[model samples]
Target: MSVVMADEAKDVHTEQLAACVRYVPPEDLKVVAQTYDGAPVMSGSVRGVQAHFREKHPQAVYVHCYAPDLNLVLCHTCKAIPEASDFFNLLENLFVSQCVYSQHDQFASIQEELHIEQRELVQISNTRWSCQLSSVNALMKNFPAVMKSLQKIRTPTALALHSKLSKLPVVYLFVVFKKLLGITEGFHKVLQKENVDLAQVVHYKSAVHDTLVSQGTAQVAEEIYAKAKAACRENNIHESSLGPRRKQKMGDFVVEVSCGSRSDLLNDSEHLKQRLFYPCINRMTSELENHFPNVEKEVMIGIQACLPASETFLCMQSLEKLASQYNIQLVPEEVMVTKSFLSRKGTEAISDILSVFKPLNPMMFPSLKTILQVTLTIPDSSCERSFSSLC
Candidate 1:
């Protein structure tokens, strides 16, 4: 997802939002328009994204009516698009407020919509079998509906219904055996987890069991099932309510440096130079300790803010190179890397330059911090005249 400055963003995160809304286009539009129906294609450009959606999901009238340019759409749709004004329609229910939709937002839309028609025969068979016999009510309900609607016809109509069911992924043993006969038992464990409120019916289980039982290969299916359970028993799955734990964000702390406010007549010029940013540097270290874990005197973390467009980046780069050679990371935890003006220049931050060769967190990789020679770029000769006159 895209990260943006809130102030400049007008309290928005557009880039990240675009990722979630990318898949609103309906499938009917894709089929009707004949634009690569069910084909694997990547969205190559954003120039005509609105037009693309109109062509893909015409049935979703809202998308066609409110087509937006790339920049605007990105901002408006990063989070869930709720139907209700109260945000009730959002996938997240109450009590799980902290849990976001997903950090991997860009792929989320694609995965939710990119369905292939029973490409994996083994998986299809398993599902069909489950629908026919197991708690898979959706499938069982559909079969009778087909039958009742066609009851006016003779026995031939009934056979056609059977044919349709057999062709479905469930009865088609080839579908299950082809590619999808996998992890039935493992998936069952996930559904049965105490925390899960969703019903626990190992989908495709009955179908696979029935097919294998009929084929006299139930022994093989049982072995595969046993292995799946063993794997789950040994492994730990961590579904994050909170993504990765991180040190306090740089924005969370305020910058308060004790410096001489430009005194009258430049009276204390030398004194001011002696400690202009000394307090800030010390505070930086202290802030690092309070916010981050296992931070040393010099470990750096990701800069919360982007580098300003000026000479600051150059200054930061120099400091980063020098800091690299020092012995650090005694405790070795998350390292904070920030871009600073003193060592950076021209749209680049100290962290940006250091990132080329330095470790993300000095606390994690002491050796990642190494001193390197850096070339300095002062102003042209024209500035020398002003400097000399001032001197």
Candidate 2:
């Protein structure tokens, strides 16, 4: 629970971690879990801090912090397409070079003239996906002002940014990412909650996964393309036609052509969806699955079933498995009686449930209380928030 300056070496980390644990009172020094970002010094599978700590405390399981992992999922997904990556890079440059401190009056004046709500452009954070949604929303809300400001400036940076911003693909990407990030914004907030538990995290993660999958379909892509097209028209930005298809050649001889004429070519909307929308959506969905696979593990399932908010709350099979795994003696009749009492409280938070038992004797419901404690000990975004504040 104490923060101290130290080297990045695994040995140093291990020593510092041990010291922190030792600082706790002997009676309360039960280490059930450890959570950290996916840093090599902290999370490396072998000979890392977590590994060394596990050697000493076998009961303390390691959990990768979800907030940063979610950010990684977004970063990897954006990088899957060259166009999407460039668009975000451009967004950062625009914020750094133009919008943040300098030209505030210019942007404000433009916003007033355009009747747009005055809002500052948000700087994107590399390790925070939640901030990206804010940045994108701010830019989208003040799109006309930004473009107008860019137009009035003659500097090389502003001119280059204006040229890129006017393009059809950039506009399409803006709309697409806004929609995609919007879908995950709620889940991101949930992850940041101080009292969030595994059951809530799993529920929101599944919802985000399903929503992203739906976004990848052709119908949704078409709707997004239409929105982008309308934005381009509203801004008076020239909508360029799709470029020529790359000719497949064999030793400089044309083997085949994708289209014989303009009539055979795909429309701009269809082309954008096929080339950009589908690929981006598919990559994001895949990355979400890859980064969060452990949520479906048997141990996690059992833990979820024990939570009051879970759909399978009070499930006997899950409770028995959890008890057996933890070596806790569970009296089924006592649990059923407790369940009837808890059921009357409706779906209360884990903290609320813990408070309900604070006045009761520990021996009355040891298994349930242990499971709840373990669930709360598993980290969420609080660790990341602390690191952010320190940095």
Best by TM-score: 2
In model 2, the runs with Cα more than 4 Å from the true position are: 1-27, 99-102, 245-267, 293-296, 347-361
Weakest 10 consecutive residues of candidate 2 by summed lDDT: 17-26
- Tens-place lDDT per residue, model 2, 76-113, is 97777777777788889888755445577888988999
> Model 2: which residue pairs collide?
none
What would the per-residue lDDT of candidate 1 be over residues 1-391, giving only the tens digit for each residue? 0101010111233321112111111111111111111112212124343235546543211111000111122122222221111111111221122122441232233333433121101111211222111222222223233223223232453444433333211221212222122323333333222222101111122333344334333344443334333322332211112222333435667434325422121212232122221222233223322322211222211111112222333244434532342322222221223323134443343333223323234333333232211100000011111122221
TM-score of 1: 0.18
The Cα local distance difference test for each model comes to 0.24, 0.69
lDDT of 2: 0.69
C-alpha TM-scores of all predictions: 0.18, 0.82
Give the TM-score (vs. native) of candidate 2: 0.82
